[model samples]
Target chain A: MRIGELAERAGTTTRTLRYYESRGLLPARRAENGYRTYDEGDLRLIQQIRTLQDFGFDLEETRPFVDCLRAGHPAGDSCPASLAVYRRKLGELDALIGQLQSVRTEVGAQLARAELEASAELPGGPEPRCELGPTAPQSPVGPNWEDER
Target chain B: MRIGELAERAGTTTRTLRYYESRGLLPARRAENGYRTYDEGDLRLIQQIRTLQDFGFDLEETRPFVDCLRAGHPAGDSCPASLAVYRRKLGELDALIGQLQSVRTEVGAQLARAELEASAELPGGPEPRCELGPTAPQSPVGPNWEDER
Candidate 1:
């Protein structure tokens, strides 16, 4: 099969396939006509690379799996190097989640404090007041206004 | 104060100050010597921007806080617009944390399944065996090897 057919079958772009070839992750066979040709094995390798990329793995991190497949392994993760990448990715994800959770907590606290301050600056301190009063200060901002922007 | 003094007090670079001025976040006055001058209020605004940046907020996201300070608010978060930004940041952080956590779980499962498969493919299936045999296959990879790279 040609490069375009392999790319179409793998649901990826020809540019990506060329990039993989440049990176030596996918080595294509040169036909007598000097055109790049790939077989079903190349399709499986591209599919494995696409799956790992979707999981946020860097292109370099997918190399071990590609090497494993090229070495005739039934699956990309069949090699020790590929398993090592999986473990490292798990650690990175945990650290990132922890940092984001901390930021979320701090932002939530800041929002609550600001709302309290705004309420205190009002005339009645967020207490129930007569809505019919013409002189009442109407705040155009609301907690639900976050979605508007 | 001059631009240098303001940047020093704000603990940021003069280039950053100029960038902020370009963005209209910090408007500077021109002295008779044809040099840029800033006041204490500019320092306060720059401080607010830096603090939010430390919290992982984008330069554009700090605009509301800067506007709030320039509007004579006691603190950056005292304004409705700043609070809106905070609320939006919280939502974004939550979504990112959730995604990272999901990736963490998936990667953890993949690592476990791959390790189990590797052990099964080994001669003893991860069971304790005599270490005296020279013919026994040794795995060069370990879970702790993630730190070396």
Candidate 2:
């Protein structure tokens, strides 16, 4: 198949396929007419690259799996090198999740504090509140009764 | 102070300060000598921008807080606009963290499955295993008794 057909079948752009070729990832064979040609095996390779990219893998990080596929492994992760990349990516994801969680907590706390301060500065100070204990049922008029009136 | 001094105090490069100026986020005053000048207020604005950036805010997202500071608010988040930005950012962070967590779980599961498959393909098949229940006391030789020999 031609480069265009392979890219279409793989659900990617020809530019991306050319980029993979430039990276020496998916080298295409030259046909007698001097056009780039690809086989179904190359299509499988592209699919593998796309999957890892969707998982936030860097283009470079996909190299090991691509190499594994090219080496005729049953699957990309069938190679030790590919498995090692998976382990490394897992560690990276854990670190990123930890950092984001910390940031989320800090941002949440800051927003709460700022909101409290803003409410306190209102004409009547902080608004009145109710814990809504089990015995104290909600008002029959509903929570937005004032709006309805 | 000159642009260089402002950049140094803000712990940022002059190029970045210029970039912010281009974005109209930080406009500097023109000194009598035709050099770009900044004052303590500009320093505060730069600090506010830096803080939001460290919290993973995009350059555009920092605009609201910068505007609040420029409007003479006590803090960057004192204004309603800044508060709105905070709320939106909280939502965004929550979404991003959730996605990362899902990806983490998927990658972890993939790694475990791959590891199991790899081990099963070894000459002796999968390694023998022990759950190490509480009832089974630890061997004095430690977990690596074979290695100890």
Candidate 3:
């Protein structure tokens, strides 16, 4: 298959395929007419690359899986290298999710505090003399962000 | 204060401050000696920008807050414009958190499935059950990712 046909079959763009080729992750054979040609092996390698790419794997990280497939493994992740990539990816995802969860909490707290302060300035506002104290923290970012204040 | 002094006060880098200035987000006045000078109001604006930046807000998103502070408001987020930005940011954060949670679930499921399959292939693995059938989904990514396969 040609680049266009391969891209169409793989549900990806030619630009992406070209990028993969440039990264040497997916090399193409040159035909008699000076055009790129691909075999069933290339298609399988592409499938391996696309699968891990969708799983949030970097191009470099997908190399192990592609290599495993080219090595005639039953599945892209059938090799130890591929399994190690999966383990590393799991750790990265866990850390990222934790960080994002913390950011969400902090942002939510800041929003609540700002909204409260805004409402307190309106006429006939509720009595809030006890909650807001002189020595209390002013910024809605909370005390943990000592560098910000 | 000079750019370096302002960056030191804001707990940021002079390079970052200059980048902000380049983006026209934090403009500085030129002294008689062709040096950049900033006052207390500028310091407040930088602090506001840095606080929001630490909260994962983009430099452009911090504009309204900086404008509010430049207009002599008590805080960057004390104005209606800044409030609107806050509301929009909250929505974005909520959507992002939801997406991350979904990805986490998907990745956890993948990890568990891979681990189970790996253990199941070990020597003297669990009883040979009839449950391993063709109808079982192969990957946790679901059947929708058939394009990759």
TM-score of 1: 0.79
Evaluate all candidate structures by whole-model CA lDDT and list the values in order: 0.78, 0.79, 0.72
Candidate number achieving the greatest DockQ relative to the actual structure: 1
List, residue by residue over B1-149, the lDDT tens digit for candidate 2: 99999999999999999888877688877988899988999999999998889899999888777867776767888766677778888999899989988888888888899778877877585644322322333345533213212
What does the lDDT read for residue A111 in candidate 2?
90
DockQ of each: 0.26, 0.17, 0.15
Candidate order by decreasing TM-score? 2, 1, 3
What order do you get sorting by DockQ, best first? 1, 2, 3
Give the poorly placed runs of model 3, Cα more than 4 Å off.
A124-149, B122-149
Error of 2 at B113 (Å): 1.2
lDDT of 1 by residue, B6-81 (tens): 7788888899998887775787789898999888888899988988998899888897787678767689887666
lDDT of 2 at B92: 93
TM-score of chain A of each: 0.79, 0.82, 0.77
Error of 2 at B134 (Å): 37
Task: List fnat per candidate, in order.
Answer: 0.45, 0.40, 0.24
Query: If scored against the real structure, what TM-score would every candidate get?
Result: 0.79, 0.81, 0.77
User: Where does candidate 3 clash, by residue pair?
Assistant: none
Cand. 3 TM to true fold: 0.77
Range of the 10 consecutive residues with the lowest summed lDDT in candidate 3 chain B: B129-138
